[model samples]
Target chain A: MFWQQLVNGLTLGSTYSLVALGYTLIMGVLNIINMAHGEVFMFGAFVGLFLVNYLKVNIFVAMAGAMAASALLGILLEMLALRPLRRRAVSDLAPLISTIGVSIFLENLALKIFGPQSQAFPAGALSGVQLQLGPIRITLVQIVILGISFGLMFVLRFWLSKTRVGKAIRTTAESIETANLLGINTNKIILLTVALASALGGIAGVLVGLSINAVEPTMGLSMGLKGLAVLILGGMGNITGAMLGGLILGIAEVFTVAYGASSYRDAVAFGIIILILFIRPQGLFGKRQGGRF
Target chain B: MDIILNQYYLQIVIFVLVNAILGVSIYMTLSTGQLSLGNAGFMSIGAYTCAILTVKAGFPVYLAIPIGGAAASFISLIIGYPALRLTGIYLAIATLGFGEVVRVIILNLKITNGALGISGIPTLGTKISKMLSSFGLSRFGGLTAQQTSNLLVLVVLIFILAFLVFFCTRLNRSRVGRAFASIKADESAAEAMGINTTYYKLLAFALGAFIAGMAGGLSAHLTFFIGPKDFAYHRTVEILSFAVLGGSDLIIGPIVGALLLTMLPELLRSASEYRLMIYGALMVIMMAFRPQGLISKETVRFWKRKLGRRINQ
Candidate 1:
């Protein structure tokens, strides 16, 4: 039972890791939380859903479509909500509120388009094959989900380490002023980072939609909060911490449902976040003690 | 008088007043530069306490309301001490988590009826009627029962507003307010100057909670129902918009914001379906053009200088 639950937790956690990766990346580069990232994720899921349901496209093609659409959305969000505020040199909280406005607009727009109801993906999209390893049972879709998520994480890691843009992102994250001194276009880097992070969020949304078999406008609300919790738990701006935090949160929630009252399952992520805030405000893997949030 | 006293209009006015109070509640904490998203949770605490006292405990509405505010204020102190350690978005996320925890707990507790919520709350209108009759002023000024109830609520709102105005003016000039402003301007500077940042932050947080709690108590009686969904993250965002869109710099900013934003939906009833969308667009536009909000110190000062000179002439 424990092993089966662990498998389920990993599947759930992988999606969380994807979302948190987006959060960590944005926080690292911009020092601001993109409140609309969750909406971007939701939009991605709807894009993938539209392709799969209406066009009967393969899952891989739908994911690519979703990623491209969401990347576009990220750029639009920057132009409409963030860039203006940054140019104006508004208060620190201005961008946060602006992103919130974008989130609200996108959410309500989706509600209008999607009719305020959960859209279910037609079944049998993935091959129905269960693999039994000793006492545990795993579905073929679960294996595919895990593979795709881990594969994406590795790709992200490699790109960040090897690519020129990746080094630029890391340098910008360290100090924007210094990066500018080095002649890197900080503005372009910020834009690119936002798009990349938003792409990850979008793909995660599609994966989650597939696993859950339903997608809705309101799906972003809970997922957004949980992603934030995972980001904090893993240490803000720590890529590896976000991944670990996601898995831990996923497992903890699964255990709560399996052994404890199922109703408190939602509380697990939030409860852990509060406890961590009290004991270790810097988070578990945070290197700096009191750096910029 | 008839138009002003109309039940529909009066109800709207009452809401505007209550939301104004909520706006001030958040403004209290914002002044200290702490971005708390837990005001809605504090409001729930106040609403539930007042509702239960009236429904199950049979306490008077007058007595239960203050107690509710007190209850929320007390809880704020407990959380503020530790949570204030984080800054910026981290503080925001922590408060957001705290709110969710409060909501989840309420959803599971039996006393909260597990999402069924508390109903059958006595309306403020009936209480006013009872009080007027006992004083043999039931027909005082020949007012109707509905008008009397609304008048009572308005009186409460007026008193609260008056207190806020006086309190804000005094705070702006007082030592504590300077401490708050200093902390907001630069915490390290304030600490270096021997100002107790923690103590003042806690005070602002607690005061904010109390006001929000009081607003919640009034709302519970007005609506005659209290539900977990009423105090969710959506509400937090709405209250936040009230302050941000209005202008947090002045005491009147949030009140003006509440008045206009509350009346906006009514004015644009034709676009009711698109109300939130419009609101969202407005927020983005406002942030882009005038991030200081609809009202700010400079605007107020500009008007004051113009009007003051005219009045003197």
Candidate 2:
């Protein structure tokens, strides 16, 4: 039972970590919380669903297409909403509110376009293939999810450490002004970061949608809140922290639900967040920046 | 037409007044650079307290209302001190979590009647009371189903709203208000300048919650119903939208925003399905074009500039 729950927790945790990676990356580099990110993720799932159902595309191709489309949407959101706001010397609240507006707009648009009912992706391809290991049963899809999530994380870690663009991203995350002085195109880097983060969100959404087998316009809210919690737990703007946070949250929730009431799952997660905040507001792996609240 | 006059218009007026109160309540903390996303939760506390007191405990309406507001205010006072230490987004998240916790508690509590919702509370919507207050007759007794009475109640609420605006405007100019402004500008700087940042922050939250509680009390009395759904996340978002869209920095902004947005959905009832969509789009456009809000002092200044040029010509 413990092993089963652990595997379940890890699978769910891996997906959350993927989404948190996107959040942390954008937050780290741009110092902006992309509030519409969850919507972007939802849109990615829709795109993937459309590709699979309408175009008869393979799952891998569908996922790639969703990621690409969502990346474009992120760029568009940045150029149109964020870029203009940045130029205006507006308050931080302005962008946050605007992104919330954008998020609402997209959610309602999705509802209008796709109807209010929950939509299910074709489950035959992903389901009905369970892997058994001594009273612990897992699905083939779960294995794939874990594999892809870890593979992406490894790739990201490597890219951040090695590549020129990666180094630029790191520098920008550290200090945008300093990165600009060092001859990096800060704007381009920001756009690139948004694109990369959004793509990751998109892919994660598709994976999660596949695992859950259902997607809806309102799914973004709960997912977004959880992702934010994970981000907070892992330490804001810390990639590795996000991963660890997601894992902790997922495992904690699974164990709590297994031992306690199912209804208290959300409460348990948020309670943990409050406790963490009380103990260490900087988060588990977050570095404290020198900014007055 | 008689039915419409007796019911629909009366309900509309009451809703506007209640929402206006809610808007202003939200604006109080917003103006102080604090964002408490738990207004709806506080409102729920007030509503449930009033409803239960009136229905179950057999309290008079007037006494029950204040008790309801006081109950919510008390909760705010208890939580505000510890929660106020967090700033900006952190504060928002904390309050939001508080709201969820409140909802979950309400969902589980037996007195809340669970999801079935409390019913059969006495109705507070007589037309004569509304009419008398509308005509500036302040001291009239509560009216019956007469049209004039409904108008009176409406006018009285409006007067109450006006007084609140006046009081808030005055408070904004006071030393305590300046302390709030300083904290908003820079908490450490405010602290450095000998401002009790902690006291002022808690005050802002508690005051906001108090007003929201009052609004909720009024809402419960007017509608004669109280339920958990009335103070959901959507309502919180709506209140936040009113403050943001109207301009959180100004006293009149939330009022204008609340009135306009509240009336907007009514006007767009034919497009009910697209209501949220349009609202969202408008918010995005407003944020993009007018981040300071519609009734912001800057917007007023810009309008004055245009008018001044026209007059000069």
Candidate 3:
């Protein structure tokens, strides 16, 4: 039972890591929480669903299409909600609130278009092959989810480290003013960061939709919050921290459900977070410093 | 049209008052430079406590409501000290978690009826009227029971709103208020200026929780049923929008925000299907154009100057 739960936890955790990576990337470069990120993820899932269910496209094509759509959405959100605020020198909280507005708009738009119901992926969307390994059961879907999540993370790490644009993004994250002084276009970098982060968010949504076999309008709300928690757990802005934190949270939740009463499962993630916050406000991996205030 | 006596309008007014109270609660914490997304948790605590007391413990609405506020305030004190230590996004996320935990606990608790919620809660006016009549006082004796109850709720809500608005305006000018302002302007500078930032922040947090609790107690009686869903995460955002849309800088801002926002959907009922979509878009445009909100100090100042010049001319 424990081993089976562990595998389930790892599968769930990898998706969380994907979401957290989106959050951490945006936070690294912009120092703002894209409140619309969850909606972006939700939109990605819907796009992927449309491609697969309506057009009969394969999952890979659906994912690529979803990524492209969500990347556009990310750019739009930055342009419409974020850039104006940044240009106006508004309070730090303004962007957060504006993104919240964007989130609400997107959510309602989705509700209006999709209706307030969960839409399921077609049966046989993936081959239903369960692999039993001596008392622990695994499924083909779970394996695929895990594989895609790890693959994306690997690609992200490589792209952020090896490429020149990757170095530019890092420089921008380190210090925007410095990056600009060094002749890097900070605006373009910000746009790229948002697009990349949003694309990752979109892909995570598709993975979750695939695993759950259904997607809905409100899926982003709770998942987005959990991603926020994961971002905090991983030491906000630290990519590695988000990755490890997601796995820890996923395992903790799965174990809680398996051993403890299932009712306490949701509470356990937050309860552990509160305890951690009391002990380490900077998060487990975050560096200790005075708050931005 | 008899707007005041119209049931729909009266209900909207009552809701506006309740939401205004909640918005002010948020403004209280925001005033001290703390962004709390957990007022909904405080509100739920108050709602459940008030409901349980009134339904099971046989407490009167007046007494039970205060106790509810006290209960939420007490919980805030327990969490505020440690939670307030973290600033900005950290504090917001911690409070968000706190709200989720509160919701889950309420969902699991038998006293809360475990998601079925508690229904048939006696109206605040009926209970108060009965209690007063028993004491040989007949404040609402002339009207029908429904009208009496509606009027009583309105009067009581207005009374509380007046007290809160007065209190908030006063607080805006008091020593603690100045401390709050200074902290918001620059926390490190405020600390350097010998202000006890921790004590003040906790005070603001607890006070905000207290107000949110009171609003919850009052709202519990307004609606026939009280459930965990009433105080979900989205409610927090809604309350925040009230402050954000109205302007958190002035005492009148949130109240104005509440009134307008409460009435917005009603006005948009013609396009009911697109109500939330429009509301959301408005928030984005409002933030984009006037991120300081609709009624900042500058807005008041600008109006004051214009009015003063026109009067002189």
- Please give the fraction of native interface contacts (Cα pairs under 8 Å between A and B) kept by each candidate: 0.74, 0.41, 0.73
lDDT-best of 2 and 3: 3
Model 3 per-residue lDDT tens digits across residues A1-293: 88899999999999989988988998989898888889999999999999999999998888999999999999999899888887777767777778888988899899989988999777767877999999889999899989999898888889888999999999998888999999999999999999998999998888899898889999988788888888888787888888889999998888888886899888876886788789876777888752211
Question: Candidate 1 residues A191-251, lDDT tens each?
Answer: 9989998999898888888888889998888888888889889888888888889989989
Question: CA shift at B300, candidate 1, in angstroms?
Answer: 1.2
Among the numbered candidates, top TM-score falls to 1
lDDT tens digits, residues B117-157, model 2?
67767645453344345777644344334555466567768
Task: List model 3 lDDT by residue over B134-175, tens digit each.
Answer: 888655435666666677789999999999999998998999
Question: Which residue segments of model 1 deviate by more than 4 Å?
Answer: A289-293
Model 3 gets an lDDT of 0.88
Q: What would the per-residue lDDT of candidate 1 be over residues B1-313, giving only the tens digit for each residue?
A: 7777898888888899999999899889888888899999999999999999999999999999999999999999998899988887777888889899999999999998879999999998788778878988776576777788788878877787789878977997899999999998899999999999999999999999999998999899999899999999878888888877898887788788888888899888887787777767877888899887889999989999999999999
Model 2 chain A weakest lDDT span, ten residues long:
A284-293
Higher-DockQ candidate of 1 and 3: 1
Clashing pairs in 3: A234-A241
Worst 10 residues of 1 chain B by lDDT: B137-146
Better of 1 and 2 by lDDT: 1
